[model samples]
Target: MLSQLQKKLLNDFQQDFPLSPAPYADIAKTLGVSEQEVLSALQELKQLDFISRIGPVFPPNSLGNSMLVAMSVPEEQLQTVAEIINQFQEVNHNYHRENRFNLWFVLIGNNQNHLHAVISEIESETGFPAMRLPMIANYFINLGFELDWND
Candidate 1:
């Protein structure tokens, strides 16, 4: 279970992680806590596996091109296909969505051609066609959800 302070800190931190050389210091000032405390809280959260990462969410065009791809992987070959897709440097996230296209992943590349090449390679290696869904535009919405620590 998280202490009240820790919970408050987490709730606030999600909205904005400081963009300073010393982000902890900035967060500390805002939360009325010491910089060490901020760092310690984040470390503790990581230890508990409540937070997977504490980093920036880069804008798509700022870095490279990316697409959401789904593939219909056989149950027996799911692991193999996942491993093959994960080997690509452009693939950032992969998961098993609940649908016909069970294996889903994100492919990010230096350019559109690079993204296409990576997808083609995965298809050739896995013998599964990847359905690509590229985001044309994004509408910002807060994706925050409350965690039930008590449960």
Candidate 2:
């Protein structure tokens, strides 16, 4: 569970990032703490694996292209197949989903053709057909939810 202070820090950071040379120092000033303390707290959070990364989250279509892919990998070879898929720099996120498809991943590429090529490569390498689901339309929803630390 995160302390109130940590939660407040995350909330503030999410809403606003300091637009200055020393961003951390600016954050410390806004949060009423020393710069060193802010840095230490961030490092501690990262060490605890609560925070995977602290940076910009880009718009998916801002780049050339992005697609969601699902593969029906055999249970025995799931790990090996996942590793192979993850090797591509174009592959951003991958997960084991509970479905007949089993393995799901996101691939972002320089263009639609490049994205298709990556999918083909994965299929050839893993010997599993990848089902590509390119986003034709999107409905943005405010999908924010608070975690109940006391639970």
lDDT by residue for model 2 (1-151), tens: 6766577666557645677899999888888988998888888788888777787766668756999999988899999999999999999999999889999999988899999998998999989999999998778643344554556
lDDT of 1: 0.84
Per-residue lDDT over 50-97 for candidate 1, one digit per residue giving the tens place of the 0 to 100 score: 787887667775698889999998888899889988998889999988
> lDDT of all the models against the reference?
0.84, 0.84
Write down the worst ten-residue block by lDDT for model 2: 141-150
Residue 133: error of model 2 in Å?
A: 0.6
Q: Which clashing pairs does model 2 show?
A: none
